[model samples]
Target: MSGGVIGTLGIVVLLVLLLARVPVAFAMFLVGFLGIWALNGWNAAMGLLGSETFTLASNPELVVIPLFILMGNVASASGMSRKLYDAAYAMIGQVRGGLASATVIGCGGFAALSGSSVASALTMGKVSLGEMDRFGYDDRLSTGVIAAGGTLGILIPPSTGFVIYAILTEQSIGRLFLAGVLPGLLLLAAFVLTITLLCWRRPELGPPGPSTTAAEKLRSILGAGPILVVVLVTIGGIYGGFFSPVEAAGVGAGMVVVYGFATGTLGLQAFWQASRESIVTTATVMLILIAAHVLNPFIALSQIPASVGAFLTALDLPPTATLLLILAVYMVLGCFLEGFAMLVLTLPIFFPVILQLGIDPIWFGVLVVLTLEMGLISPPVGLNVFIVKSVAPQVPLGRIFRGVLPFWFAMLVTLAILVAFPAISLILPTTMFG
Candidate 1:
């Protein structure tokens, strides 16, 4: 059989295996290894696997993953996340729908610390839901805001989404992290606007939170200031050429650990718990990366991306049209696949097409990450939706899904803005380093 035909069949079988509940990394590894064997030979496949595994496993750059993850976990266990939410809430609590807006801001802040959307959703849900509930905020708005806002975790810097995208495309992780800044901020603003409009339309949906006195606001700010300072210094240092992304991660992790201990929030037990969780999360990411490396060579042997590129080129569609079509496919797939799993499975096919079209990789990374953010709140497999449901068992899953709709629309708006003006995603990266 022709290599292309075999490659196509391999992908089909991979999908079947994934749907049948095979682990994502394992499914990719299996299909990729076998496809390489089929297309080349047993000796080549074994050699490819060994070299790919060793190279990926030994890369010093990957240390950033565990450090950033540990920073986030330590922050969460130490109640630093709550302080962030408190700071945002104190600043905006009196505004109508302010609680929801605060939740989004809090999510954005924590996202800067933790790049995992699941972690963001889980942490913010615990921190913000009870407060919103106490304020008599509508269930839909409360749960929905947390679920949707939590998506910023993957779009903001320190984002695992961007990190994985960078490794896959061989783009600069620093540039990708910087590229995420504007788009992430834009999406966060869009969500806040969504909440404002929703509350404006139906005041009862989100009643105004209790007005905070100046003293209370000052106190909350003082309470959270140190951790916020740590976050800003870490990210700012990266942007200012004082550190590489990996170095920034290490600085951030060390500062957070020190803060946790100094404040007595991170006891021995808490520290151990954070370390264990970080290890598990880091291991999961490494396995996916290793699997991606294994699958990449098989895809290249297939020429599937070339075929798709030619098809797109033959149709002579505008670049924007082609890009939109590809993203639409991501949206459809989002209904079924986990975000990171989807990223590993699809970038091999789609990223090559992106480069073939002369698209800027960093800008495309921001746009693609935003779409992945949508998946976190999209139906069926809306990972954040399930996360919110877990946090608020009394709320119907449907209600949480309903709550995410406006924010999903807000995401679409953010995506359109970024696409229309690529500079929105690239300006910071280009200005600082380009």
Candidate 2:
């Protein structure tokens, strides 16, 4: 068989395997290994695999991943998230859909510490769902809000996905982390506004939490001091060049651990638990990454990205128009694909074309993150929503989907704003890194 035919067939087999519920990383690895062996030879394939594994494992930037994961786990287990939520709730819980709005605020704060969407979803869901349910909040709206809010885990600082994107693309991890700030806030605001509107229209969606006195609200604000301190210290360290991205992660982890211990929130058992969880999560991500690194050579050899670029460029469309088209494609594909797979599969093909079109890579990175965040809450395969569903089985899936519609529109608007004014995503990075 021709080499091209072999490559195509390998891709087909991968799709079939994925449909058959094989893990995505394994399916990708299997197809990649077979394709490389078929196109070249066993010795060459084996050499590339070994070299890629070594390089991926030895990467210094990757150390940040586990550290950040540890920071997240430590912070979550230390009762910091509960304080953050309590503070946010004290401020927002008096309004209609107050608890829901508070969930968004709390999730955004928690997302700062927890970069994994699943972690954010599970943690915040545990914190906020019961409160919302107790307040007679609609299960659909309450669960939906938690699920959608959790996606900020990947959009906000210390995001595992953004870190991986920076590593993969050879971009500055610090800049990417900075670049995510405005967009993350934009999504957070959108969720808050959506909750407000939903509650206004359907009062049963969420009832106001019991009001707090001014003094009590002030005390809650003070209680949030620790969370704010950690966030500012970590971000300031990164942006002020006091620390590299990896160093900042280490600092963050250290701060979280110290806080946990000093406050007596984390005992030896909790410390051990956080470390074990971090190791397991980091291992899973690294394994997938190593597989992707091994597969990338085969993908490059296929010339598929180049071909796709050529095909797109031949359309003679304006850069902005092409970008919109690409975003549309991302949204559609998101309904069926998980975030990491979608990114790895498309970045090679699309990133080059986007760069050639004179789009700023930093700005484009923000846009891509936003698009993938949508995938987390989107229907059919919205992983964040499913995570919430697993916790609240009584709420039908369709209700969650319907409840996210407003926030989705808000996200679309935010996307348009970023596209129209790239500075929204680029200003901080340019100012800080310049």
Weakest lDDT window of 10 consecutive positions for candidate 1: 337-346
* Candidate 1 TM-score, true structure as reference: 0.98
lDDT of 1 by residue, 1-434 (tens): 98789989988888888778788899989999999999999999999999999999998888889999999999999998999999899999898999999999999999999998899999999999999999899999999999998999999989999999988888899999888888889899999999999999999999998888999999999988887888888889989999999999999999999999998989999999999999999999999999989998998899887787788889898888999998898888887888777887788888888888898888888888888999888888798999999999999999999999999999998899998999998889998996
Per-residue error (Å), model 2, residue 387: 0.6
Residue 215 lDDT (model 1): 98
* Candidate 2 segments exceeding 4 Å error: 1-3
Tens digits of per-residue lDDT for model 2, 324-432: 9999989987888888877766776688898889998888888988899888888888899889988888888899888777777888898999899899899889999
Query: What is candidate 2's TM-score against the reference?
Result: 0.97
As a whole number from 0 to 100, the lDDT of residue 274 in candidate 2 is: 90
